[model samples]
Target chain A: MSTRLDFFIDRMVSQRACLDFGIAQTADMQGPVFELGLGNGRTYHHMQHNIKGRDLYVFERAVASHPDSTPPEELTILGDVRETLPAALTRFGATASLIHADLGGHNRAKNDAFAQLISPLVEPLLAVGGLMVSSDRMYFEALTEMPLPPEAVEGRCFIYRRDS
Target chain B: MSTRLDFFIDRMVSQRACLDFGIAQTADMQGPVFELGLGNGRTYHHMQHNIKGRDLYVFERAVASHPDSTPPEELTILGDVRETLPAALTRFGATASLIHADLGGHNRAKNDAFAQLISPLVEPLLAVGGLMVSSDRMYFEALTEMPLPPEAVEGRCFIYRRDS
Candidate 1:
């Protein structure tokens, strides 16, 4: 495993790589951006600028980001991801072209379990050829690993392209 | 300097980081994405997908990329960048929001000189709060070094945020 700083950087770098690769795969794709976790909203804000032209819907238990990073009320889907995610399918439907799943923290065991629970609900919303950039390794039947952008450690920042 | 694979990865990772940070800095600014060197067109293609809703004007010496990576004719500004770039000001007129400069090669000294020569003309087109992601150590009077994203070898992937 990498150091704490490396972990932090890996998440960012891998996510960026996924977005870049996702763009390559789906240049014509026009769909909303989905956020599995809106942690500090720093990544969310970063995603907004880097990956422009997509409506962003965020899932969070509570609004904990710095006031500046706070997303608008409409874009925020509150409540625990385990609960809010199901509701996302009904609202957004299968329309997400890019998903940044930054869930799971230091607790490897708990996060693995949580990732299992959340992934199914989230997977349905991603369009075919959509990109899922996640911190924890989650396997969806329809998703396959895409090449990682340089500096991304294998297994650390997992990137999958939804194919089915 | 990193190995060839590392260098390739560094270029993409740093570019992604810069675009991500640049987006955070300027959410409302609307301008075209600029490219100082359109090597292979992979990064430009990635930018197209990762950063949507922006016009991309690429400066390239010749049609060099794989056919699939090619940009449309309207977006391609072909010629010596230094000569063509000045012409760009007449057409684009200081309206670039993000600049991806992937110039320089085995000849570090020559590339440094080229970067310096090009920086002045290119820098003016970038908006006050735009972003410039480059490969060398070229510094613009109005631009400042944005923090290097994690794992970005210092001096390899230079990210500059333009602050008027």
Candidate 2:
């Protein structure tokens, strides 16, 4: 029970950080909202509702979310994010203002490895001063750690800004 | 000690809620950020750095916060918030997109009454779809409760959106 509560809190805090990034910073930056995970589509839907008028381009392996939650055709990137993200940059241009990386799994080792794998690929696409809001901390050259807001518990939500 | 911890968690959850509101909704809206309290300038500083290029207007009884953290002369509204908020809005115009109400004293009854006192004066100034991120749950007719993001412990933070 306690573990479940912790999971809920962690996701809640991290997701809030994502929203704050959009309002506080992404509002000024030009580009569509991007996400690496479309699981359940909860986060994607939340972003759409909160950031009205922003386009969301997502990379997913399959149509995992409820049909109602899926992004429209042309917005969804089918296949593994590791390969699709680079292809996406070529198509969309490196203009993502906000990127929410929600890639994590029940296995910690795998999740950690996956984050490392994609960090390099994702780095170049973020526009200057764009935000990378993630579930886990991913280090990339030129990205600076933005302080977590007061409501965020340490280690729960990781936020970084591309300063350059 | 436990009481202090609870207070911290509550504030943290609410602050996360505030950020969620901004990202999810306020980023698309127009207007400057407004604050009802300026204690220590911690929250103010957090907002400025995270939100990026947004002007912050603050109301305080006296000058407080670190010298470096203070908002500029034009942005800081001195004297009581109930008075300062209205006059400042007259100058700044009724276009505040994000309003952070942090008025909290140890006394619950006084805080409740103070919330009531300030609600009417603050409401009209919020642009439609602007956010009212407060320490307490202030019920206004036009405001709707945005679901608290996952990390937020229920009742710890209160968030309301100006739907109209």
The clash count for each model shown is: 1, 8
DockQ per candidate, 2 decimals: 0.02, 0.01
> A11-64 in candidate 2: lDDT tens per residue?
665566555665467786668778788887767766766665667888888877
**How does candidate 2 fare on TM-score?**
0.49
Q: Name every residue pair that clashes in candidate 1.
A: A150-B9
Query: How well is each residue in B1-164 modelled by candidate 2, as lDDT tens digits?
Result: 22232345456656755665564567766588887788767666666655645677888898777654688888888898778877877877768888888888656778878888888788777887787887776757677777777766666566777766
lDDT of the candidates, in the order given: 0.73, 0.74
Cα deviation in Å at residue B72, candidate 2? 63
Tens digit per residue, CA lDDT, model 1, A38-147: 77665676666556567878888878875656789988888887778788789778878888788877678998998888778778888877888888888576778777
* TM-score of model 2 (first chain only): 0.91
Interface RMSDs of all predictions? 15.6, 16.1
